[model samples]
Target: MMMKAVLVDDEPLALGFLKRQLEKVSSIQVLETFTYFDSSSNISVIKETDIVFMDIEMPERNGFQLAEQLLELNPGLEIIFVTAFNQYAVQAFEVHALDYILKPVQTERLKKTVKRAEERINAKQEAISEKPTKLCINVSGELMFHLTNKDPEIVTWRTLRARELFLYLLHNRDRSINKDVLTELLWAEVDQEKAYAQLYTTIYHIRKTLSNYRDYLTLKSVQGGYKLILSNTIIDLYVWEKKLKNLSTLEGQTIPIAEELMAIYKGGYLQEYGYVWAEAERVRLEQQWVEAAQQLAAYYHDQGNFSSAERWYRELCNKHPDDEISNYQLFKLYALTGKNKLAEKQYQIFKKALEDIGTGVPHTMEKWYMNWKQGIARKTSM
Candidate 1:
């Protein structure tokens, strides 16, 4: 396969020479050359191009920064940094540049870089084609499929109906969903006959998308309905909830386990998708996480682990900024630890959060703060 490349060098001589050298390699096709990095002009070409040969020292920006931006646009785009200095070699690899070739690029060295780029591109393509043995469905944030020993693959649905239908089936997997219910839920705007036809077409697309994971996920028709069966597959939310249920009382031995559970919660269930059907589950799972986090923080506070307590409470406050109990706990913890400024900051945050929702700080909390302030004033006078 021919690999398309772009050359970016501030020096006209260097840019022309690199392009000429690349021309020597039959596999490398020079698509575009740039004297400077211009986002507007370069972005469109960079998207289609396979490789970029960039100089480390440029007028607008260093090659490392430019490469980072390019990678963000096309993550699969290979970057080969060409420069006169040997010092930038280490920095080149730091940004994951494919190869670092010195200036006055040799034909042999250039060929080696081209070969390496081709190998990497081919490997990525092969990985995409390979089927996964086991599957892990992540619904905590966005919908993602984490295949065993492979990067998470985001499913690209053929159409909106196909996406919603597949998510609905996955959400209620193992139970046969009647065609009538699905039709009413998704295709209510269409006529009955047209709706059914659309459903069938959507299901076909879903099946084709899941063809690689057929061994793990089986979507079958069951007597006027459809069912999605999971074998050797797990959903992150289910696994997290199960572990939370099985967890015993929090202690020195169980603290690590609690921390591990906290790490697993990437975000609310299907948070990014914003599916109305998933709202209840999302709120429920979030509450579960909040409760677990509160229990862990309280345990640390009770055991006189003030530092750990502060850390967990801060985490809770970050995730649920309006959580009054967590904010109060953090305020008290900071006060006890002699971080009066942080304690006051926490109180102000709590106050603003409550006020935003048309509420005030609880009377008892206000009274406690007033009393604490008076005591501080008395001590300061002495």
Candidate 2:
């Protein structure tokens, strides 16, 4: 079945251009085109479509605002944004949009995005077939395994490492773990020959255990060593990471992604493993989180939503207490809101935190904090 699509752009040229470009791909069926998002119009015209190619700068309401309304009528709709600006990446992903195509969409990129959509749709359809067969496999006497969320035969409580082969491969996501690295990470103390033989046996058991659902997941040998080939369907972490990306972008528009991001961020990422790549990714995402909060705070502040700005600032303060600039901003904001005591308290915290970090306050900020605190204290005392 062909995937239905629609183009929503207020600009005539942009709409016409995307329609023509998308028409090149016969598989993508553009059902309708909307110049603006008007509820009075039968929104179902676009809502019924499987995918939406929407523009952010449409008249009346932007893409996100429009998407909120559209999804009320169509929950599972996939939106691919066609935008002239890239700065809105955060907002795009915040909504869980399928993908973002910059203006003047390239044929190759559009095709790739379409292919990805096809893969997802196919996986979803397969999931609806018959509730997915739930089965289990016991690897040797130590390992228990699962399919479709069903726990395997438990001779004993187990972890992925119950089968050393799966443990090493599972730890390596989308990357082939080298035999030497596996030897080092898995069994540095054991004899090399013994380790290799054990590894081969482990691999065989893994394949045997997972053979039933091989289409959904597999362990395959590569030039380097081997790869655990699992579809995006089974890995909740992939979905979790992608949800973060959607919330992080300006186009991956899905509502409730915010709640999902917060819920999924219950703990440090991949808390079970401390692989170098995993740790690096964790730090990168954490940095991105702070940067995003800062951007959103500044955006809200400029939009005259001071309360929201202050909320984000406070969160940032808690996360990055040593940031002198963030502290200064909060102190000033507190003073503006007539919370002199709170401002004074925050300034002291800032002073102490700065001192603790061994970075002295800047002269300009020091003068302001001193002056503000003294003035407030004098006003209270007087």
lDDT for each candidate structure: 0.90, 0.70
* TM-scores, all models, native as reference: 0.62, 0.48
Model 2, TM vs. native: 0.48
Q: Which 10 consecutive residues of model 1 have the lowest summed lDDT?
A: 125-134
C-alpha displacement of 105 in model 2, angstroms? 57
List where candidate 1 sits over 4 angstroms from the true fold: 1-133, 377-382
Q: What is the lDDT of candidate 1?
A: 0.90
Candidate 1, pairs of clashing residues: none
Q: Pick the candidate with the highest TM-score.
A: 1
